[model samples]
Target: MTPGRVIAGPGGGIPWDLPRDRAHFRAYTSGKWMLVGRKTYEEMEGWFGNRTPLILTRDPSFVAPVPSHRVVGSIFEAIELAKRNGIGELVISGGAEVYETALPYADRLVLTTVETEIESDIHFPECRDPENWTAIHREVWPSDEENDFEIILQILDRKSR
Candidate 1:
């Protein structure tokens, strides 16, 4: 979740560099990692350690490497498992569907709105305006590479009910 910044990864706008240097990288995530899929969770292994992971999957073939992960039958099941396990912070990663299902429960959303709309087969969850949420901050940054457009990082917080 490391700071939970989301990105669309297309077009031109501003620019920012990815920090390959470990010393400068700031991790902004805590609590049990409740990832939405086996693949998505596995890809982020570098960011996880002793933190337990809740993986949502009905596929019998999906096997996680450690006992720290619990495979669930459905998205709702994973949410229940996360709550039962006392997880306060969660990040909804891709496989697309997972993000759609988990967005309802996220209190904080970090979105990267790209300038160029690269047509993808999949899209992130469509979040317009919910009664409980509002954009708290939106800052622009340059794309990591040359010719790529700028991207906007948005932080949305849940307005108190």
Candidate 2:
């Protein structure tokens, strides 16, 4: 999932018009299993219909809307479940807390640098340490009438430690 460059807006959530980002999001997530935080899952409304969802929440009594979806209490449990299901490449989509939790283990990150800066309480963690990350791909999207902000999409791969 693509987090805003500033992570989120003043409301502590992403609040911007980004059609191109939406397109990019669909392109990557379509027909894939998504590992998402509970809050993030709740924020979505009828979106991501094509993907399987694994919701991570600390509440053991939590229930999922669909029977096909699974809920786990910890990231470790999620990882274990993903492994048992033979999920080869895991994608950790997030809320800031979950992003921070997954940072050390994340093999790759799809970062979309939103051009315009806006106030935000939540922020994406800095991953610029050359020893840990290396940019594998980069593309710049200019702003347009449809999307009010320009964005730079970058793919970062974690270096073998």
Candidate 3:
């Protein structure tokens, strides 16, 4: 089943774990994506080498470690710049705020319910209405020797579109 979009056009979500969000953008953005957080921005510089990244931040004095990236004033501007690239897909890698901000824009969710419940200071919002979306595809994987939990991958699609 199609989890979202036309199955190819627009954007899709994938559940992944990287110490920094930059790795996610670098690994994914050969397709054009916007890294949506301050830490995600910092992590990209060292991890992505010299690839240009677009960072979204409202703070005016936010100085980036690398000039290959620019801090945009808003998510709208960041997305607009990414759209201008005309690359067919965008990945919204999160740090909570970015995910919440972009959730309304997504038609599909590439989700990974981690094998272990992380004691995170922040958490991803839950989908309360199952009718709004469906898990078209799912997979289970072992977390690792350190973790006894199992991770679940779910691809969810919007019902109406």
Clashes of each: 15, 0, 2
Q: Taking the tens digit of each residue's C-alpha lDDT, what string does model 2 give over 1-161?
A: 23433676667567777989988888898877778889888887467687878899989899998888889888888889989998876677787878988887888888888877676767777665657788999999998889987788989888885
Please list the C-alpha lDDT of all candidates, in the order they appear.
Answer: 0.59, 0.80, 0.57
List the candidate 3 regions with Cα displacement exceeding 4 Å: 1-31, 43-45, 49-52, 144-148
- Sorted on lDDT, highest at the top, how do the candidates line up? 2, 1, 3
For residues 1-161, what per-residue lDDT tens digits would candidate 1 score against the true structure? 11222332324211234442121222444444656566566656566665566777768787777766677777777767777878766666554667777777678876655555443345566665566788898877665654255656678898863
Q: Which ten-residue region of model 2 has the weakest summed lDDT? A: 1-10
Best by lDDT: 2
Ranking by TM-score: 2, 3, 1
Give the residue spans of candidate 2 off by over 4 A. 1-5
lDDT of 3 by residue, 44-154 (tens): 446545345567787899987766666777777876876787745556766566776877777778665554333233555555566899789987656555444455557
Task: Report the candidate with higher TM-score, 2 versus 3.
Answer: 2
User: What shift in Å separates residue 84 of candidate 3 from its native position after superposition?
Assistant: 1.3
Off by over 4 Å in 1: 1-26, 30-32, 42-47, 128-132, 144-148
Question: What's the CA error at residue 101 for candidate 2, in Å?
Answer: 0.4
